[model samples]
Target: MTLHQQIKAASLAALQALYPEQAFELDQIAVNQTKPEFTGHYTVVLFPFVKTLRCKPNELGEKLGDYLLAHTSLFSAHQTVSGFLNLSIKDQVFTDLLLHNFNNPNFGKAAPKSKKVMLEYSSPNTNKPLHFGHLRNIFLGYATANILKNDGQEVIKANLVNDRGIHICKSMIAWQDYGNGATPSSTGIKGDHLVGDYYVRFNNEYKKQIAALVSQGMDATQAEKEAPIMQATQAMLRDWEKGDENVRQLWKMMNDWVYEGFNNTYARLGVDFDKYYFESNTYLLGKQLVESGLANGILYQKEDHSVWVDLSDEGLDQKLLLRGDGTSVYMTQDLGTAKLKYDDYGIDQSIYVIADEQNYHMQVLQIILKKLGEPCWKGIYHLSYGMVELPSGRMKSREGTVVDADDMMDEMIVLAKEQTEAAGKTEGFSDAELQDLYEMIGMGALKFYLLRVEPKKKMIFDPKESIDLHGFTATFIQYAHARICSILRRENLPIMPDSSHFQGFVASEKLTDAEGKLLLSLEQFPEVLKAAANEYSPAIVCNYAFGLAQLFNSFYDNHPIAKAATDEKKNLRLMLIVMTAQVLRQGMNLLGIRLPEKM
Candidate 1:
């Protein structure tokens, strides 16, 4: 067994032996290598066993520490404070774990047999171009899937497009009226952005029509009816539903353009999806489910003939399944999508990465799916994260105030390029080289900034703070890896270690504080990965990367791996440094961020 596993096993064995009838089950054995004002390389907690042991906290901790030290070679010394047992492992044991990591590149990705999991996010509407908010959703969804896959779960990444809606018809109406020959290229705008502009233009014209009617002393409802934009949009929707050839062709054309633009951004961001679902296709499928529900009497029709499900007892209002005119609502399409996914993927679990604002809607979905007799309802998870708000307030698309995703990416690239120029790294770089590096740094910064925050907490997106790459940022971590590579290159070391050189390396009693701490941090990576998987939190991995980088920086400031007096100690330290680099790379990969060889 590995050293960590051995340590945990020894600890567990002692606990079981000391309290024979206490039914001690090991929950977790963390390595809190740092104490507030103490001396220890690892602190373990035995609080969970206190109830069964029926002893005071201090007594229980002391007994466990005594049991572990006497029975196991895992710790050289240990102490108990309150209910916590702080144990320092033998230096050789810690070094052995580092060597193991150095040998195995995929140190933290081990797992049992994998199971299938479905993940869905980035459900953008066809009416408008994707914006900065969609970037958050896409990044989280993509990163979560990577982490789960790394943890040995088979993941299916998917997205849903809201294609058939009133908002979409607004774009179509404006295109028909004022976009006779105005293509995206002709107007020097992206296809999705161009279509979205027309959507905004339609609203503006409709508002003018409303104002004109209001001046004529008409009420708001009358003014809305009198507006030609509304009439045109309604006519387009009718034709779209009726499968009119001209309308279908135009819809396909516009949707293709928007999708092309979306794909380009997705490529740049290093995000991908295994499948796509469209509301146009799923809405009809939902109508079928609604019909089935009505036939089975699981759903009832109101006096107005609108199909509704009563969930009032669950502290939720009755929700509509189908409108009086038989049009499917948002819930209808989601219900259909869930059923379809069961047949297509048979996922063991399905997670939806959505904003916390839709908590109510998702709850309703879960309940409705259960009432509909779907077995997978119990397995559906709404991985709700809080909003990414600006300093001013939340973004509202209807007000034309949402930050466009493509524009934001372009701006980030520009900023990255400017930084590269200021750093004087662009002197010998070609345009192609500059473009590649800019994309890496730009998207890396963006993804890291979003992933570093706790997914459920509301975060303020400050460009000024995010662009600073010196501390706890993607560029900082990437720079650490690059620095290691530069030093290794100058020394002409092999990429992989020489096992002959690794055996019987001499110890250094004169190690610096930072080197010791960094070595300690390297040993906790496997445990960190396991914790991240267990808690379903990418922020755990992010925090680990930040801590590792900080420790490595400290070591670089104090110790020189290249100029050490002893080759044995120098090679050993370099091995630890390489192991640290691998951990950072692996962690960043789980968050869907890449490391550039140089910066």
Candidate 2:
């Protein structure tokens, strides 16, 4: 256990004994390490228990405080003041935990006790390239998977490519109609972007065609409906299903281009899939499940041939499983996918890293799965996240306002190089060295900007502010790491004074400034990881990295690590820096950021 966990656990035991009737959930107990000005090492708020125990606040604090010191040998000093218990830990124990934190192999890993989980995200359509909106989806999906894995759950990251749909057919049809054998190489356009251009072109031309029909005295709305496109697409699908050589050849060629384009984008963003489910494969399975549901009386078939489940008793509308023509809808494919996943993995939990907009869909899905007698229904989780918006507005691809993910990444790398050059920090580095620095800074800025915000809260991606060096950005943290590395290089000495040569290392009154405070902050790294896992928030870990960097900066401003008067004191402080670097590296790794040694 981490020192923080041990401390919290010890305190909880004492509080439970004092207030037996009070519900002593650890979440209700706030144990904060005391500030530099305070005398204690940690403080606990007793106010939460005051009303529960029906006792005097100060008296309750006193009793709990007394019990803590008497029962736990970790704390060196203890006191009660104003309904709060303040306890100070011995320096030896504090330093020991710090040393152990860096040396322990599983410092940030969680204990594996139970359950395996499957997560699905980034199910993008094939007609277009990934954009800023998809970035939010990708980051949230990846971060959630990392958090779950850190929480000791077996996590499988999966994706479902929307490879089959009318949208894709629109692009294919447009390409076939307009192209006189013009290829991506001939047009000098990226494949996905090229296809997307044709998709937009198709829409513009289709609109004009519909307008001509309306001008000829047709109902405008009815004339503009997708019935024509749907009919053509369905005919193509049926042909492809029936092994028509022409349709099969065209579908394979177009899908290959889209998949290649998507793979390039996914590689740039550092995302991969263990398995992929195509709509082509799972779309038909829903019909089978619907048939089974009908046989078992879980659903009712209407006179019009529509199959639905009446969920009005559950305060939800009746959801259609199969359409009148026996065609499966989006929800049907999802049901089939769920069953397929369970049959494939038999996982203890299934998590869908989907947008909050689909919150209702998941709720209905879980209800249907439970009613269908799926054993794994109880473990289904919808990791619903909010939208990513710019300062102007939400990204809309149809408006030609979406920021492509690859383009944005390239922009960030350029900005990072500009920042380093403008700061004159690239003087001593070669071109290759400078390029490496650029990638680290760029990725750090990207990951930190995304992970620092709460996933469920809408975030504004301010370009200037996101890469700012003065605030809570990844660049800021990377700069701190570089600064420390610089100091260590200048000193050129072993930070660890061979303990075999000394009786013990001691911290005198002279080392009682920000150095002490920084060391204490470093001790909280393991605890930060534990809290991040428990809360299922990468924001917590992101915040900890910023706080650690801030503390290190404060310590560097006041304490002279490279020029301390005594060798022992300087070595101890250098050890603190080494420990700090390790903690920073581990914390940033959890958030998918890297720390460059030189900025």
Candidate 3:
């Protein structure tokens, strides 16, 4: 168990012993790190017990503190202030924790767990390249999966590609009408970007058609419905659904180009999926499920032969499953995909990393699934996150105003290079080494900035602020790691210190304030990892890493490691910094960031 857990357990025991007639659980005993103004390492709240036992706050605190000091060697002293019981842990405990885990790389990871999970994210369409708005969703999902896996959960990363839809057909129609047989190879453009251009063209032409119809005395709503491009796209969708050979060929060719482009982007982002579900493959299964629901009286059929589910009793409106023409909707494919995932993996949890705009849709989906008596409905979890906007406001994909992911990455690399040169930190590196270092810092900054915020809160992306070396950014942590590496190399010490190096250490030796603070922070790494997993948020890991780095910097500034007054002190500080570097590396790795030895 971690130090925090141990503290909570001990507090529970003490409460039970003091008040024999009262019932207490471990979770009820709140334990938090003592504030800097206090004189302890951890503090337990005494307010809860005082009200229950009808005793004064300070009196109850004194009883509990005295019990802990007399019964366990965990704390050396205790202080009570305003109903808070603070306990100072013994110096030997911190020394022992550092000695036992300094050289261990997997110090914070949990053992394998029995529960299985499937995380779905980055469900991009085939009509456009991944833009800046998609970055938050992608990074959050990827980092959360890594954190969960590190916490010992069996995790499967899945991606559901929306490869078949009318939005895709809009791009195809535009390309067929306007392009003189221009391909990605012929136009010297990325496949997804090429398709995106045609998508924009389609919107532009559609707008002109609408305006022309309106000028001819047609109502605006009628003009939108009667637009030639819309009619053509609808007809193409019908043809593709009917298995027309020519339409299928065209659809396959365009989707393949988009897939190639998407793979390249995913590789650069360092994210991959264990499973891939396509809308084309799953929509039929959804139709069958709808038919079954109808036969079972769980769903109703309209007069036009369309499928509907009345969720009025569940506080939701009627939902459409299929059109009168037998074509499926987005909900249909989603239902099929949910069942397919459960059938394939039998996972205990199915997490969808979607934006908050789909909150109502997800709610209706779960209710409908439960009405159908599907077992997977119980496992459906929507990890809803808010949208990522820019300082300039929201982006519109069809109007081609969004920042492309590739362009953003390239810009970050250039900015990194500029900052590295300005700081005069690029000395002693080859051309190839410089390029790799730039990519590491650039990508690390991007991912860290996006993941540092709580998932449910909307954020604005500012490229310049994200790469600041002195701020709460990945660059700060990466630089700290590199500093530790530089120190170890200059002292001719091994990066991973051996236990024998600290053989002269005495457990009874007193610790400096800086040393104790650093050790305390190091001992909390395991607890931090567990908290991040439980909350399903990478922001927790980000906060821990940033705080640890800050503590290390403070420790180094106030104390000298290599030039300590005693050899024992030197060895102790060496072990502390080495373990700090190890933890920083592991923590950043969970966020898909790489720390270089020299930056």
* Candidate that scores best on lDDT: 3
Q: What stretches of model 2 exceed 4 Å from their correct place?
A: 12-30, 33-37, 48-56, 59-63, 103-105, 226-243, 462-469, 491-513
Instruction: Write one digit per residue (lDDT tens) for candidate 1, span 1-599.
Output: 44456666777788778877756455555534548476666676766666766788788778878888888777777888767777776776666676666757778885754578899988888877888778888888988888888878899999888888788888888887889858777887788888888888898899999999899899999889978789888888899999999988888888877887787778878889999988888887777877888889988999888999988878888899999998888899888898888779989888999999999888999899898888879879988888987777888776797877887788878888888889887766778877988887888887888888888898777544535655778888988887887677777765455566466766654445566677778877877887786666788988999889888877877778888768866877788787888888889998888877667
By TM-score: ranked, best first: 3, 1, 2
Residue 285 local lDDT, model 1: 79
Model 1 clashing-pair count:
0
Q: Which candidate has the top score in TM-score?
A: 3
Each model's lDDT: 0.80, 0.77, 0.90
Best first by lDDT, ranked: 3, 1, 2
Candidate 2, which ten residues in sequence have the lowest lDDT sum? 493-502
lDDT of 2 at 420: 83
lDDT of 3 by residue, 207-304 (tens): 99999999999999999999999999999988988899998998888888889889999999989999898888887778888889999999999999
Clashing pairs in 2: none
lDDT of 2 by residue, 1-599 (tens): 65567777987898888767666888888888776566787888878878878888788867877787788778777777777778877666666655455334456677875777888889888888888778777877787777778778888889988887777877777777776666677887777887877777677777777877788888978777644653566676677667788876877787777787888878777778888988878878878888888899999999999999888989999999999988888888888888888888988878887778899999998898887776767878887778877777887765667777878789888889888889888888889999988988887787777778887887777544535655899888888888888887777633222343234666443446466577677776666776776666789888988999999988888888878778777767777787777778777876677788777
Give the residue spans of candidate 1 off by over 4 A: 1-9, 19-36, 45-63, 81-84, 426-431, 462-466, 494-512
Those runs of model 3 whose alpha carbons end farther than 4 Å from true positions after fitting are: 462-469, 500-508
